[model samples]
Target: MTDNFYMLTWNWLADSPLLAAATEVTTKSDGEEGTFVLAGVLLSLVIIYFASKLGGELCARINLPPVLGELVGGVLVGVSAFRLLVFPESGSLAEDSLIINLLQSTAGMPTEVASSVFASQSEVISLLSELGVIILLFEIGLESDLKELIRVGPIAAVVAVVGVVAPFVAGTLGLIYIFGTPVVPAIFAGAALTATSIGITAKVLAELGELGSEEGQIIIGAAVLDDILGIVVLAVVASLVKTGEIQISNIIYLVISAAVFLIGSILLGRLVSPLLVGLVNEMKTRGQVLLTGLVFAFVLSYIATAIHLEGILGAFAAGLILAETEKRKELEEQVVPLADFFVPIFFVCVGAQTDLSVLNPAVPSNREGLIIATFLIVVAILGKVITGFTVFGNPNLNKLAIGVGMIPRGEVGLVFAGVGSASGALSEATEAAIIVMVISTTFVAPPLLRLVFKETETATEAVDKVQE
Candidate 1:
């Protein structure tokens, strides 16, 4: 029966013009490229969407930040283990084989059909991921209250400066002394450590119900400033790497540009917001004003990036400037859905890049790599922790908690690692070390915050009873 069917199939192929043309073309030509690319993108999206949702739920159940779940999901998808489950044939094509050569050659073809396939499918997923980050930053900005930051001005500034400087110095010194790595990579690694992940900190504060309190305000305010400073540092380091020369004039320009952008954005927002509100009120369509504000945020973010400043700074500044407007709540409500979808993509992508398979318990035997990693970790921790000592006034406030709150490295660290690796400033060992620092910072912040906040709550309850 199978032999007869094969004969019939051959007869049909011989008789049909389309089938014969397709067969002559092979998978390398126009025949199978669409199918493979479509499959790859669809598979990626399904995995990402489910992983994000599952991670969010798991994080909440474990009393940890939902970002943790997203990170874990990213890791699962990135690792060889998960890839095998999804794409069993990936990375396994034998050499000198017709199928493998066709797949490889066809992959590079600039055919209209292939481009259309990528644009229709893969491009959308990539765009959604990018949009997720933009909206996420906008929401972060919307949630930020500048008045609270102003109220804690001096303290926040001090904390931010100390926080940036300490880890930077310690990290650089550790690399130079312990690893004997080259100057550029060491500087890059140290710079990566200097960033503090305020998102994790903010989430913990909200969970602890301290987000509206004075101390909480101070920490959040400092973190905002810290982010600004961190970006400036990244810009400077990047400039140095590119030119092989760090100019004092360039550093001055960067600082001035950042300051001007921040002040100008707020000033412009203040001037425009009244008119914006009036327009929104007149329109009365659901989310019209909020959508307008979001567009404005994106515009400002684009302008900032054009001027060599971080686009997120502009997005954040726009949010802070508009925070006091009457339309703030409406804007927040309108933007929440967009934020919910895209933000997890940013976190998951970050996690996906982390390759933990290379991390070994026997790293110590690697001598230099192990020592450098350990030293960098210690420097990363202590430098940020000591920033708590810089907290002025309120001797009763837990500076340790504030310092610990600033520990996670987040996107900023990844930026540094990417720049360093791309520029050939970092070796594999150094890059791995930086990744370890990021992982350590992310893992440590939540539990430490939980314990500190718990103790603070107990103490507050005791004090309230005493006052009564």
Candidate 2:
């Protein structure tokens, strides 16, 4: 009787003035809402570019990786700091975003519809951030020397395999046993340790004039292979995270599918390379080569996503394939502008979404996360350092240099953190811990690399003097 009365009363009031006025107040025209969304996005981009460039410039000036600066910049502007670039996934409300606030306060954006606009703006920025990573992987694929990688195969393969397995095992088991972290999150954090920042390492080597040295070649080759293996591991772990349960059959299926996707993409891509070149050559129009290259990359990225794999993997494979073509050099040069424009967005966004409050040791609950970060840092350093000794038959080789070169996690580590966070596979503590580990390893490795190489050089000088 009570329910019937309420239903009748509600139905009677549906067309009443009170309900009509309430709906009118809450609702806005689609055009007005879209305009607000665009305004919010534009303002956000302005912030992103400023932060990325500012951070990158400062880091570049100080001899650290410019990428590190970008991450820091993001933190300063993100949830932990100014609340400038907050996201919904990182436990932030739409009102928490200063951009949304600015839109309403300045642009006559209706307060009732502000939440919708914030969501729309955030979704667009997130998409752009993802695209930035895809381009980054593509650029990495182009920079890799497939032919040289093959030539240096045996020793490089050993180093890469050891580099991956050691940290992965150590970090995963340590997290599970010591911290009592769940299996999937533990695996994800462990995988973050397995990345070697080829860009950072290569830059350091070039500065030290070791780019062509035997150890350098070995490091280069191993890092390239490390990237491929890391991608596969990411695919597998990310798949496990999505399913929320790990079955042996599922693992086998993901592994097989990843392998088939990468290998088939490469083989088919190589065959299609000639046709790509032919099409580009036939076009007398401007921008054909660059446009065609991007098309191939996007298409592969789509295919990868459709198959429940990472689109970045497809983009990387696309770069690797196009890298084998006659236009490889030209395509590489052309892609740099795009990379410069988009890649920082990904790095910055990773930093922005990270909540560093969990790193505070003062909070009793936060203590475990701090300990986890420290453990990961130790494992990350030691794991790759062990890979240095994996090389054999080269008594003169500076094994320490090889190991140190693989230590910096750099951009690749951030990729793992981003994916883990996005998938809701990591807790705030674990995510922050992973981010801390990445930053520590990245900053620590370059100076350590320099020190190890210096020792090797000094010892060589002493030996030469004695022989003389």
Candidate 3:
């Protein structure tokens, strides 16, 4: 049976036209390397352009996040079933064959070259992803009214702290005790749960017309702090992993750096606003200032990487700084096209990395994989929900609603999962669990939030009637 399986796999490999062409090219030099490189580049661009448009249309039709569509497109390409059904290559096309052969040959290359190429590709993808995230953050900052956050200060603080603490503790304990995973994996699992997709929650609030309300302000403020705390936890975990000790000095440094970055960015934004406004007014060159702003963002992101902080952190800081400028609206308008082009790439690449074949339910009965996934999901849900009870003031307000509002993990969670998997800190099973957690969180938030907001509105109307 084993031999038959091997034979079948070999036959499939041999019959692949892509594999055959790649071998012929490498062996006989039938085509120029430049031609192959150009073809690869064009293919990637074509895939990205059409997929993004198709995904956007599908998302609008289904009322789903456009990101969801991008992911679906990636899955269609990466998954075997989709590839077989759609492309249906019978191993004849040289272009397809060459690509397959090139990938296989590259896989067997010397460790250094292979690693270097992988790292280069990963870095390019990451840079594009960071650019998308920066633009997203800038939009968030531009839309935010700081006065609203200040009005809900105490409640926001309580919610943010609870949101961070509960998830970290529950996730760590669940992984360690329930799944019996190692301490490092448990730490990473816990860290993954800490990110709250402010974007998702804010979108829901906006749709319901609650975005300008007190509860909305509190949720948004808490989300900002939640993100800050999440990154701190990640840095702490990474430190512990590398040194086998959670260095107090390192923690202090990260905290201080984060504080400085946040505070300084806001201050700088305010101070630089007049000058930026003048420059934009003076230049009168359409979109040139926005281009400069992008360059600044990249510079800050590079600096953050140099200082051992995440590039997105620097990107966010740059966005915050730019937020206070009078030209924010114009900048946002100019940046949207670039964001739209690159953001889907990030989502698609993430989806491509997910191999669903490992998720087969029939194999490995009592399946440790399924068990871990279930355990992580429970922890992910319950932990975030606990934050609702942390509301310090206004007992009448639904703190549970606020907590649930912060539940979706989104892109940041995927970043943590990818980092851990790449570093070999997380096994395939654990990575799958994290991915499931992200998907669940994304899918569950909007409907849950709508229901909670409806209840809140009904209660408010009743109170108003009584007062009248």
TM-score for each of the candidates: 0.81, 0.79, 0.75
Q: Which scores better on lDDT, 2 or 3?
A: 2
lDDT of 2: 0.83
Instruction: Tell me the deviation in Å of residue 223 in model 1.
Output: 2.6
- Candidate number that wins on TM-score, 1 or 3: 1
Inter-residue clash pairs, candidate 3: 17-91, 17-97, 18-96, 18-97, 22-98
lDDT of 3 at 253: 85
Segments in model 3 whose C-alpha atoms lie over 4 Å from true places: 1-38, 79-126, 150-154, 198-217, 395-401, 422-428, 446-468
Q: Give per-residue CA lDDT, model 2, range 23-129, as digits (tens).
A: 78557467789999999889888899899899878977876556667778888899889999998777788889999888878998888888888889989999998
- Return the top candidate by TM-score: 1
Which of the two candidates, 1 or 2, achieves a greater TM-score against the reference? 1
Sort every candidate by TM-score, greatest first. Answer: 1, 2, 3
Q: Where is model 3 poorest over a 10-residue stretch in terms of lDDT?
A: 84-93
